[model samples]
Target: MLLPLRRALLLGLATVLGQIVWMRLATGQVAWVQVAILVGVTAALGTVFALNFTIGHLRAAREEVKRLGVNEERVRVARDMHDILGHSLSTMTVQLGLTRRILETSGDAALAAGRIAELEATARTALSDVRATVSGYRALSLDSELAGARMALSAGGVRVELPAATDAVRPELREVFGYVVREAVTNVLRHSDAELCTVRLGPAWVEVTDNGSAAGGAEAGNGLTGLAERLAAVSGTLEHGPVPGGGFRVAARGPTAALDPAPSKEGEPI
Candidate 1:
C-alpha cells in the first residue's frame, strides 16, 4: 500500500497532467475561465468526499453507542434475575426440607401446610420481583430483605441475630446493602453448616457472619459476584472470606462518611 503522503503526491501530479492535457486539447492554451471551472469542480468533489467520510464516522459512532446500551441492559437484567432466583430457590429448598422433616417426625399436617404456604408466598414474591426487574422498575428495600433473611435462616434451622431496625443505615447505601444481605444470607444457607448467623448493619456498612465453616465452599458465585458489582456501582467494596478461626463472613463497606453521628448498637438475637 502506498503511504498516505506518497499517494496524495501521486494523485496531485496525475491531476495536474490531466488538466494540462485537457487545456491543450480544448483550446491549445490555458485560460483563467477554464482554470476557474476546473478548480470549482475539484473543490465540489473534495467537499463531497469529506461529507461522506464524516457521515460514515457518525453512523459508526451511533451503532457503537447502541451496542453499549444493549450490553448494559443485559448486565442489569442478568444481575437482577440472579439475585431474585438464587434467594428464592434457596429459601424454598430449605423450607421444603423442613416441611418434610416435620411431616416425617410428627405427622403434623397443619405444620406442613403452614410451611407450604410460606413457600408459596416466597415464590409469588420472587415472581413479582422478576417481573419488576424485567420492566426496569425494581428497587430493593433493606427492611424487606432483612425480613426475608430471618425467615430463610429460621427455615434452614440456623439461629439468626439481626438488627431491630435498619434506620441507622444511610438512605443512599441501603439498596446496595440490601443486595449484600440477600446474597450473603443465600450463600450461608446453601454453602454453610452453621448453627448461628448474624447480620450487623451500620450507616455505611453491612456484614453477615455465620458460625458454620463453609467447608471450602467460600468461593464467590453468581450471587456474590453480582453483589460486588452492585456495591462497586455505589463506590463500595465487598469483602468475603473465612473468619480468623472458623466460619465465613461477607461484608460490604461504603465510603467513609459521617452519615450517623452516633453509631448503631449491637444487633439483638431473634
Candidate 2:
C-alpha cells in the first residue's frame, strides 16, 4: 500500500537532481553546494525506499514460515493420535470379545476371572498410553509389544510362539518392528479364527504367521494401512497375504543400512 508513495518520492528526488545537474552543466555555471544537496537528498530517499520494502518482505516471510511450522505440528499430532488410538482400541476390542465369550457359557469361574483381569489391565494400559502419546512421550518397544502380543493372542485362544529374545534387533529398528508386531497380532485377534500364531524376528525384520483363513474377514483395515505408512518412514517394507495352502502372513523388513541386513524370505509364499 505504501510502496508506491515511497517509490514516487525517491524517483522525484532523483529526477530533480538529474535535471539540475544537466542544467548547471549546460549553463556553464555549476554551484557545488547545490549539486551536493541535490545528490545527498536523492541518495537518502532512494535508500529509504529500498529499505522499507525489504523490511516488509522479511516480516512477511517470517510470518509465512511460522504458519507452516504450526501446520506441520498439527499434522504430526494427528498422525500420532491415529496410530496410538487405533492400536490400543483394537486390542481392547479383542479383549472384550474374549471376556464376552467366557461370560456366555457356564465356564470355569477362574478362567472368566482371569480374562476379566487381563481385560481390565489392557484397558488401563491403553488409557495411560493414550495420555503419553498425547504428550508426545510414548515410545514403542519391541519387548513390550512382544509381551502384549502373547497375551492378546492367548486371549483369542490362539497358540502363541515368539522368539525368546529381541536382543538381535538394532536399537533404532525396534520401534517400527514393534508396530509391525502389534498390528499383525491385533489383526489376528480381531479378524481371524486362527488356532496358532508364529512370530519370527531377525535383526532387521519381523514376521507373524497365523493359521486364520477368514478370521474376522479378509480385508485390510486402517490399522494395517497405517502400519505400512509407518514402515515406509523408516525405509522398511510391509508384506502380507495368505500363505499358499492356508493361513496369513504379515512381515516387515527394515533398511539394510541398519546393524544387520534385512532377512531373506525368498521361499515364503505370497
Q: Which residue ranges in model 2 land beyond 4 Å of their true spot?
A: 1-25, 28-61, 215-221, 240-243, 257-261, 264-270
For residues 1-270, write the lDDT of model 2, one tens digit per residue. Answer: 244766667777677777787877898777767777877886687678679889999999999999999887676566667666666677777777776777787666788788778778878888887788778788988899999888777766789999999999878889988888887887787677789998888777888888877745245566677777888888888878777667888878888734555434442533
> Lowest lDDT 10-mer window, candidate 2?
261-270
Worst 10 residues of 1 by lDDT: 261-270
Q: Model 2, residue 25: displacement in angstroms?
A: 8.0
> What's model 2's overall lDDT?
0.77
The pairs that clash in candidate 2 are 191-215, 191-216, 192-215, 192-216, 193-215
Q: Give the Cα error of residue 189 in candidate 2, in Å.
A: 2.3
Residue 160, candidate 2: C-alpha displacement in angstroms = 2.6
